[model samples]
Every structure is written in structure tokens, then in C-alpha cells.
Target: MATGNKEIVRRALEDSWQDPGVFDELISSDYVGYDPALPEPIRGPQGAKDNFKQYSDAFEGAHITVKDQIAEGDAVATRWEGRGRHTGELMGIPPTGMEIVVEGLNLTRLRDGNIIEEWSNWDTLGMLQQIGAIPSATAAQTR
Candidate 1:
């Protein structure tokens, strides 16, 4: 990764959750997230912080460890792992105090030393299924 991109990732990951300043340093004022879960992309650094707070509240201390980073031009692809214990509501589901180890990738597009846009792919269904928050097939397929 380029020095600036790595710096951005470091601030966003290694510090963001613990320190809000990370957002100030690495996120754009007009940021956008292409997450299907959100109807529209977050429009700024504060918006990004807002989204993180909601999810972070659900899984306190949850964090991502980048397994690999592929940087190409203005984009960076990161493969990471997230580990946390359910301690608050998430997606209308109450906490079960279960621990989740989820792995996924996040691809970000940066410009002017800040994240302008992002796309993420993660195991949502698998995670809910693992935590018993959603039903999974057992014994045989349902009709």
C-alpha cells in the first residue's frame, strides 16, 4: 500500500473505533459507502462515524485485522478478519452474548488522501446463522 493509503487505513482501523479523530484525518467530507445495507451512502466523515457507532455498539471491541492489501492506482482491496462478542442489538436482533469471528474484504477508493468511496463484501448470512440469530437447515432441507 502507498504510504498515505496505509496511513489512512491505520488511522481508520487501529484508532477510529477508539478515537473519533481517525475519521477526521482519513475520511472525506463527501464520503460515500456502497454498502447494500444502507439505502444511500454516508455523505461525510461524520456520517461514516455514525455508521460505525451503530455497529460498534452492537459488538464492543470488535476489530478487523487486514490479512492482505492490494493497492492499485486509486483503489485498495483489503482482506480482513473481524472478531467480537455480541453485547448489544444488531439489525433488530437482541444480543446473545455470542462471539463472532467474521472474515471479509473491503475495497476503498481514495483521493486527496481521504476515502471518497468504498465497497465491502462480508459474510452477513453466515454470521447470523452461526450466532443462532437466524435459522439454518438441520437434518434436511425445508419444503
Candidate 2:
């Protein structure tokens, strides 16, 4: 069961963001997401799609690589790194054509093999700095 749970999360990470319908298969209808980037709780598969769509739309070649994963007692935690080019608008910031890499970890809880909730922590500020949306400390220091 632990391995099955882990596989489900892995498949979702690989396919769900781009194929919105995959969320329905992987995420529970009552799924809720907790993340600093989210303005409110994510409810259901559509919410998951919407959350991921922001990144997918912004980065045409975006891809997430799973660095590590662990599963226990109906829960799975995944550490991942995502990289891509800034080819479109993201969170209202226009594209800067910068290649960016962001690392994050998520802990997902499952109910009957479906993701019921997820909590994520990621380097949002670092991404912003990489895309030049915000100046880095070193860049600021030089001015």
C-alpha cells in the first residue's frame, strides 16, 4: 500500500500538471492544498490544475524532477526540483526569457489512493530573483 501510494504521487507529478484531467484520477474531490504561493485553499482536482497551470503556462518547457520520495501510513512526501525558461507571464510578471530552477517539497495525504491534501514549501523568492522580478541581495549591494 505504501508503494502504491508513492507510485500514484509519482505519476501525478509526471502527468497531472500538464494533463489537467489526470488530477481527477490522482486527487480526491475534497483535496486541499496548503502553500505560501496559494492565495486560498485549493479545493478539488480543478484547484490542483489551476495551481499548476500558472507554472505550465509561464514556462513552456517546464519540467519537475523528483529528487526524493517517501511514503508511510497513507502519506507521501516528495522533494523536487523544477526547471524551465520564462516564456510567458507568471503571477502577472512578464517573461524575461530567463532559465529558472526552483526546488520544493510537498507532503501529501491520501484517502483511498487519492490525494486528499497537500502542504508545500518552496523557494518562491529565489525564483523571483532568478527571473529578475526582484533584485538579489548581491545585485542590490553593487548599486
Candidate 3:
């Protein structure tokens, strides 16, 4: 069951960035996402697909790697790292063509072999700094 859960997440992340339709197979109709970037209770599979599209649209060639995963009692946790080039607008910030790397962890809960809920924590500040939306601390110190 744990392996199945991991595979579901792996495919979901890869496919969401490449082919969003995969969500129809992996996400539960009653799915909900707890993410800081989105409003509470992000509605079902379509919501998940849309969220991924937002990131992928901002970062062309965005790729996510699952560095580690652990599952027990219907809950799976994944540590992930991702990189991409800022080729489109992000949070209204214009494309900077900067390469960005970000790391995060996601905890997903599965019910009846499909993802029902997820909570994610990621390095949004770091990505913003890399894209010049926010000044880096080092840059401020040097100024």
C-alpha cells in the first residue's frame, strides 16, 4: 500500500507538470489541498491540476524530484526538490529568465487508493528572491 501511494505521488507530480490529465486517475473526487498559496480546502482533482499548472506556467521546464518518501497509516510524506527557468510571469512578476531551485515537503493522505488530501510547505521566498521579486539578504548586506 505504501509503495502504491508513493508511485501515485511520483506520477502525479511528473504528470501534472507534463500532462495534467493524469490527475483524473490519481486524485480523489473529494480531494482537498492545504497549501499556503491557495485558499483553504482547495477543491478536488481539478484544483490540484490547476495549481500545478500555475507553477509550470511560471517556470518553463519545471521538474520535480522526490528526494525521499515515507508512508504509514494512509499518510505519505515526501521531500522534494525542483528546478526550472523563469520563462513566464510568476505571481505577477515578469519573467526574469533566472534558473531557480526550490525544495519542499508534502504530506498526502490516501483513502481507497486515491489521494484525498495534501499539505505542502515550500520555499516560496527563496524562489522569489532568485527571480528578483524580493531582494536577497546577502544582496542587502552588500548594498
lDDT of each: 0.79, 0.89, 0.88
Which scores better on lDDT, 1 or 3?
A: 3
- Clashing pairs for model 3 are none
Please give each candidate's TM-score.
0.87, 0.95, 0.94
Better of 1 and 3 by TM-score: 3
Roughly what TM-score does model 3 have, to 2 decimal places?
A: 0.94
Candidate 1, which ten residues in sequence have the lowest lDDT sum? 134-143
The model with the greatest lDDT is 2
Question: On TM-score, who's better, 1 or 2?
Answer: 2
Query: How far in Å is the alpha carbon of 132 misplaced in model 1?
Result: 1.8
Show the lowest summed lDDT stretch of 10 residues, model 3: 10-19
Give Cα distance to truth, residue 89, candidate 3, Å. Answer: 0.8
lDDT at position 4, candidate 3? 89
Per-structure clash totals for the candidates: 0, 0, 0
lDDT of 2 by residue, 15-35 (tens): 665676889888898999999
Q: Write the per-residue lDDT of candidate 3 for residues 1-143, one digit (tens) a residue.
A: 89989888888766667778889989999998898856666779888777777788999889988899999889999999989999998778999999999999999999988999999899988999999998999998999
Rank order (by lDDT, best first): 2, 3, 1
Ranking by TM-score: 2, 3, 1
Report the lDDT of model 3 for residue 115: 90
